[model samples]
Target: MSADEGARHPEDITVPDAVSAPDAEGRPRRVTRRFPLFTRDTARPEGSGRAAPLDAPAPARQWPILAVLSLVGIGLLLTALDVFRYGTLLIGVALLGGAVLRWLLPGVGMLAVRSRFTDIATYGVLGLAIALLAMMAQPDPWLEIPFLKDTLHFTVSG
Candidate 1:
């Protein structure tokens, strides 16, 4: 048969029908499919796989402040029990001096001095008034002002 006659034959060109499946090495070209937001089966996760179960317990949180507060309470109790003058002086100097030092820095000094003076003057006047009242009153007075006396107590005699 002539080359022209063979080319014209139906068996010459092999066109695959839809019924034929892809071979092992040949994967069929994927068609772009759109999924609606409401669709269930087509929906996939954003980044990773399945999320944690609803019933799973969450991680516990802690408060470091609470621990510090408890330690402070213990320290205060110990200080109270000791009755040491040095301990009292140390706490007073450390806390009060640190506060004063913070205020004493260049820009802060003026406001700090003003606050200190106001407090000193107000407390001083109050202290003096209480002292005068306590002195004039009887040995046992119903009202006791702490600023007037170092040791304020009521003594009863039968």
Candidate 2:
């Protein structure tokens, strides 16, 4: 036989785990285990094998905010029914509650609510001022005019 004839035998080479190996029955058996995306780092074997945990701690519980929000919702319902004379006060309380939450727990507070309450309070105060001014300027709608005393009829025709 020549010196280079089949010198490298197939049995001498080491095949990776992904390649199927024959079982005792001479049938190829599948390799179930998956290989890592990257080869292991030679410098640190333990660090390369495991990854750092990424899960964060649970957020702290906030109960006062829930209670205040519930109270504000109930006040809003009463104001909507027209049974409450202090509707603005109820609305202000709700807005103030949101503001307090935002101030106390900024991470948990809704950003939209905080921004909206700022504008709501500003415009609400202005609107209340204008309404008061109008009320002071005009006479009551129930009062009668002197010039058209005889011509005006009290009864409805329809």
Candidate 3:
């Protein structure tokens, strides 16, 4: 027996056929059958692969959100200047405005940080609470809340 007729070694094994099929032109084309690294589809949901169009314009109502936020900032500035009454009022108004925007408009762009009902309820409640608090503040409160005056009496002996 010659060297060719001897027992076949593992290194001498050869693939019987080409892995890839040729194109219409009949050239030897490399076909790749890629198996995904991850077995499950982890990238995103199946149908939501496409991205939004670049040319789509943003909603026009987004400006109101900015205006409301600016109002809150102005309120902060006023508070820093010792005008707590007007400052707190302004903050409340801004929050109320945000609530209104969320309520009236379907899409508030960046302002839609939470669900519609949640955002509206939060803004409205918070705004009303702040406004009420501001009205009941010390020194010279604007509106005298009826029962709150007697309810908030706390005496501490030094």
Evaluated at residue 37, the lDDT of candidate 1 is 29
What lDDT tens digits, residue by residue, belong to model 2 across residues 59-97?
213343454566557766876887353443554565555
On a 0 to 1 TM-score scale, where does candidate 2 land against the true structure? 0.29
Task: Highest TM-score: give the candidate number.
Answer: 3
Q: Please, what is the TM-score per model?
A: 0.21, 0.29, 0.58
RMSD to native, candidate 2: 23.0
Error of 3 at 32 (Å): 33
- Report the lDDT tens digits of candidate 3 across residue range 45-136: 22221122335444333565677889999999999999999999999989999889777765566666566777789999999999988987
Better of 2 and 3 by TM-score: 3
Task: Give per-residue CA lDDT, model 1, range 1-158, as digits (tens).
Answer: 88876554443444444234556877644423543324335432122121223353321111222232344455456568873333333333333333343333322211222454453454345434543443445546546567545444333321
Better of 1 and 2 by TM-score: 2
Q: Which residue pairs show collisions in model 3?
A: none
Which candidate comes out best when scored by lDDT? 3
Q: After superposition, how far is residue 50 of candidate 1 from its true place, in Å?
A: 47
- lDDT leaderboard ranking: 3, 2, 1
RMSD of each predicted structure: 29.7, 23.0, 14.8
